[model samples]
Target: MTQSRRYWIPSVAFCAVLVTGGLAAWAETVYVQAKTAQLRSGKTSLDAVVGNVKYGDALDVIGRDGSWVEVKTAAGAKGWIFSNKTSSTKPSGTNDTLARLGHSMRGGDASATTASAGARGLDKASEGYADRTGVSARDRDAVDRMTAYQIADQEVEEFLREGGLGEYAK
Candidate 1:
């Protein structure tokens, strides 16, 4: 090959790589769906925590293996995160609230982990329903009790393992 042609070939190859990398980034960009997610060093959450991601945090898709996704954080931390903790689309106002609620329900501090209910939880529709409906104080108390119930992480892990759930089936 001619000397000039050899240089041109490498330049073309470099450009191709750059283009492919850019496309891959946009194709599967995922946002953290959990209020706080630990990015592990391996496919399972049992691995060492390499980093942490919070709700709505954008993560560049590096690769995927079953229910685990390899990601690079904006701060350049690379690790594997469970697919259940991420979403293909960015979180919106409603999604953000849901994610926070999920975190709070999972035993996180109610006031710290989630946005105030008065802001996101209470809206015109909910207020209207409450005003029109004749939900008794006793029934409301029962509902509150049920919603306050929190499951331990160990129980969840055991359930997943015993049931062969998620990546465990593989």
Candidate 2:
């Protein structure tokens, strides 16, 4: 009975160590949240870059060192990336309000009030303020051009692909 007890204790201890080690080595999936992220050989920014990932890219998080996370890309490349650049959840889509508004406006079903407001350029209060501030038409045109510019989804996808970002890298 004494011999059996000794063997049982060692077996239980061995099993506990195995379980603990397995848990420590467990990996979690994380998605890239930045426009571009560099996978470095070390935890610091000064470390050599091993690879690059784009927004919405997925990685297997294997370990962590301070603010840096060790990750493995889908291609099986291992490196460290900043923890702030990754998210547990995948990005839903673009959050650009102006882009959404532009799509709605170009859909040809905008309300009369919207069309009127756009065509009139500025409300009376705004026009008065602009005149008082000496704002020029050139400045307004430049603003309009900047606001009117919209990045197409295809273009963004191509850019991501070219940069080996996100799903493209997968």
Candidate 3:
């Protein structure tokens, strides 16, 4: 090959490498829905709640896996979010609240866990009221909250159930 042609070929190859590498570094911003959302440092609430999130806001995509995405919001905030709850869904306020509840159930908040445990105990006491032919209203409320909290943890629960945790095990 001619000397000039050989130099041109290598230059083109170098440009291709640069373009591909740059694209790899390009971070994508995704929008959060207008609902309760939990952002955690890791896949579960056991990972600290990294940030409080709301709907219709953008967070930068840092990484992803099935059903989860690692995101960084403006101000350099970072966290993991359920992938399904983000972008192009109709009015998913319920899921958002569920996600937040998962955090509580997983001991994401120290104060919330204590309060929730107390509520659970109170709820069990209300079962005694059933003997009197009326539900203990307070206990019923506590049970309802507990049930909802478990449901909120369902995603992380399912992930663990399906051996997703194996990926993180060291």
> Per-residue lDDT of 51-118 in model 3, one digit per residue for the tens?
87777777888889776789987777888987765784334555598888897688733333234445
Order by TM-score, highest first: 1, 2, 3
Model 3 TM-score, 2 decimals:
0.39
Off by over 4 Å in 2: 1-26, 95-136, 144-170
Candidate 1: tens digits of C-alpha lDDT, residues 128-168: 45558976656654654565668876587678778887535
| Candidate 2 lDDT tens digits, 51-119 | 989999989988888788999999999999988889999887695778788878778533232233464
Better of 2 and 3 by TM-score: 2
Candidate 3 scores a C-alpha RMSD against the true structure in Å of: 13.2
lDDT score of model 3? 0.67
Better of 1 and 2 by TM-score: 1
Per-residue error for 95 in candidate 3, Å, reads 22
User: lDDT of candidate 1?
Assistant: 0.76
Query: Ten consecutive residues with minimal summed lDDT in candidate 1?
Result: 110-119
Query: Which of candidates 1 and 3 reaches a greater TM-score?
Result: 1
Alpha-carbon RMSD to native, per candidate: 9.0, 10.5, 13.2
